[model samples]
Target: MTVGYILGYDPDTLREIVDPEQCAERLDEIGEQRSLPALLERVWLLKVLGRLDEALVLAEQAVRVARMGGTRKDLLRARVLHATILQNRGAFAAAIQELTTCAEEAEGQNWPLLAAFAYQHRGKVSYDAEDFVTARTDFKRALFLRQEGGAPEDQLESTLLAVDAAERRSRSSIAS
Candidate 1:
């Protein structure tokens, strides 16, 4: 949730919409820079809607905007979102590379939350690619970081993901 941005519209209202396109369209119409958060949200929906090309476009724009005037942590979060789009697109190698860079940068800058988020995303990509061992390690580190940072909400989410990764690792181990 370190997305470093916010939407103009209410969250529950948007989630209630059956079609992501409608939400994305409404967000796009805002046309203001403050709408960057909305744009990023649309990018996520576009990915879920299988509009890969548009998702990439918006994700790139997000990164650019973040770099232009955002804080260091903002840039880090934006890069994480960009890597997330790549991850969803099945570009696991590229996603891993991007997340690794983000993780290193965040850690160096003393932004443990962002670093943990990057690790979590990389864990997801590795899990999707069936690299269970790496996934487990990544998730374990992510959970530890989240807990150490005392972000209860983030720790909860990461904990669930870590549990899933752990199960996958167990099954993979049995199979191997």
Candidate 2:
């Protein structure tokens, strides 16, 4: 669990790079001998490979380990990742609830980056449910937080898309 190597991989890199099964299996083996961060990485790799159920189990273990270790940051990350898995599985409402809790926790901890991520995820959940107004509000909040946190330009594109979608929904509502 080298922090530098872990932090070096941006979201685009994570989304683009597909590890071979042999690599993932090796990671899993190494993870079995390590701490929460290694386990979390194994779960994340599995999730990227579309093994949602397996990732969910590993995520649960991560949450449990984080809790036992009294590592709030790790717990929060595990919760968010698990919520993302749930969202991918079509459990929108549950994902929203988890993200909402995560957002509140981030706010309490003064972690604007985490709050922005949680709000962004919450907005996606709202968009999936066709609640454009709520989605727009969440997106706006996420955008503001991201800007304050100095997030990358590509990250800002999600806010742009959310705003565009919300405006389209608003126009259609007006026309109808």
Candidate 3:
């Protein structure tokens, strides 16, 4: 699990060297061992590598395992990752729904960072759906939480970009 976390967090470097298939295989092995954290990390890595289909499959499997193990946290994480995979596959509405669930769950747990991430993704989904107002609201919430959490500069930049994009879309709509 530690190894998976290390690898997943360094996806930029890992993606440059690790094969998707190898990562997927490792995820399968980790899943077989019922290592929830490892499974989550692998799903994240797979998503970063653009292996959405594989990630979705693994995410579903992780959810099933979480359910059977009665691990609510793992279930939530798996659902969130599943939503990410769906988003990558262009299933925006489904992704939004999943992210909504994640946001609610994270909020319940007082996990600000998780809630922020869910909101950020939900905002992106709304943007894709051409709902600029909602996107802007969600992005603002995400940006606020991220800033409050002292996220890295790069993360703040990305959140700012989402906010800017949403604002631009809203302005364009007003002009039209």
Which candidate has the highest TM-score of all? 1
Question: What are the lDDT figures for the candidates, one per model?
Answer: 0.71, 0.74, 0.74
Per-residue lDDT tens digits for candidate 2, residues 1-176, read 32222222222212223445654666657757448877777776766677889878888888888889847877888788788778767799999999999999998998888898899878777766777788789989999989999987766775666667776775687788
Which residue pairs in candidate 3 collide? none
Each candidate structure's TM-score, on Cα atoms with residue i matched to residue i, is 0.76, 0.74, 0.71
Q: What is the lDDT of residue 64 in candidate 3?
A: 85
User: Which model, 1 or 3, shows the larger TM-score?
Assistant: 1
* Clash pairs for candidate 2: none
Residue 58, candidate 2: alpha-carbon lDDT: 84
Off by over 4 Å in 2: 1-34, 169-176
Cand. 3 Cα-lDDT = 0.74
Please state the error at residue 105 of candidate 2 in Å: 1.2
Where does candidate 3 have its weakest 10-residue lDDT segment?
A: 7-16
Model 3: per-residue lDDT, tens digit, 1-176? 32333322222111123456666666566664446676777777777677788778888887887778846666777787788778778899889988998899888887777788789888877877788999899989989888877877766766777788788888999999
What value does the lDDT take at residue 28 in candidate 1?
A: 66
